[model samples]
Target: MAEEPMHSLARRFVDAWNSRDTAGLDALFHPDFRWHIAVTDHGDPEMRPLNSRLLHGMNLPWGKAIYNKKETIDIFSGIFAASEQFSLDLRTVIASGDRAALELVGDAVNPANGRRYDNLYCYVLHERDGQLVLLREYQDTLLLFDVWVAQ
Candidate 1:
């Protein structure tokens, strides 16, 4: 199979994210896809997000996982639904044959929590059969906890 250009995939990703378009996001991924979010290392035990138990008992240097495409879509859909406003500001992106790396600033207001969820994210994507098959994301998990997890 031929490799897809990372720039094109990156653009579609950004567009889909900015618009909270779950279908568009779905179209960009392979049937078997995984989304991993980096665990913050402040020398503290991680309290898994109550809404997503997908990471239960799993911990890897790469991050925590959401097993497949459907779950990924479900989690993202929840985020979109709960947010009063959400968007990503792209900072930089670099791509090679079947891999792409992205840097972005996330801005969102979770009305449920009434807190602004602003974060810096770095994502590494791996493509298979021209669709994204794996993604490992790095971000400030502490901010994530404070905004969405802590009471």
Candidate 2:
């Protein structure tokens, strides 16, 4: 089968997040997927890694780090479980060959704090055999700290 266009794949990726569909994500990601977050200076210095890092899961300061597909699914499951509503709005997507970059904004209310969590994110995805093999995610770490840590 021909591969789906990268932009279309990116849309489906957002859909998977909005729906909290693990199976859909499994279908889209390669068996050995790797996700990287570009950590920044902000929040407690404790949260920053001593060195560069590549990890799975959302890696929010409040939770333990998760490092694989199953763990990632579990993390999202917990997020959905605690949220009254979770949504991701895709602002733009640019693709070429097997790579794509997506700009998005996410909004949700965590039942634990009744605080709204909203942030902008950029995802750089690399695909192989029509499946996402690598995802590099960039976001405002300070905003994350404000929402998930500062309280």
Q: Which numbered prediction scores highest in TM-score against the true structure? A: 1
Clash pairs for candidate 2 = none
Q: Which residue segments of model 1 deviate by more than 4 Å?
A: 1-4, 40-64
Per-prediction TM-score: 0.78, 0.77
Q: Candidate 1, clashing residue pairs?
A: none
State the lDDT at 7 in candidate 1: 71
lDDT per residue as tens, model 2, 1-151: 7655898789888999898887898788787765655453322223444333533333566332224566665666777787857899999998899999999998987666667778899988888888887777788876775566554
CA lDDT, every prediction?
0.77, 0.72
Give the least accurate 10-residue stretch of model 1, judged by summed lDDT: 40-49
Residues 1-151, candidate 1: write the lDDT tens digits. Answer: 6534887787788899899899999999899887766453322235344445764443332233444789788878977887857899888889888899999999997677789988999988888887888777888876786777666
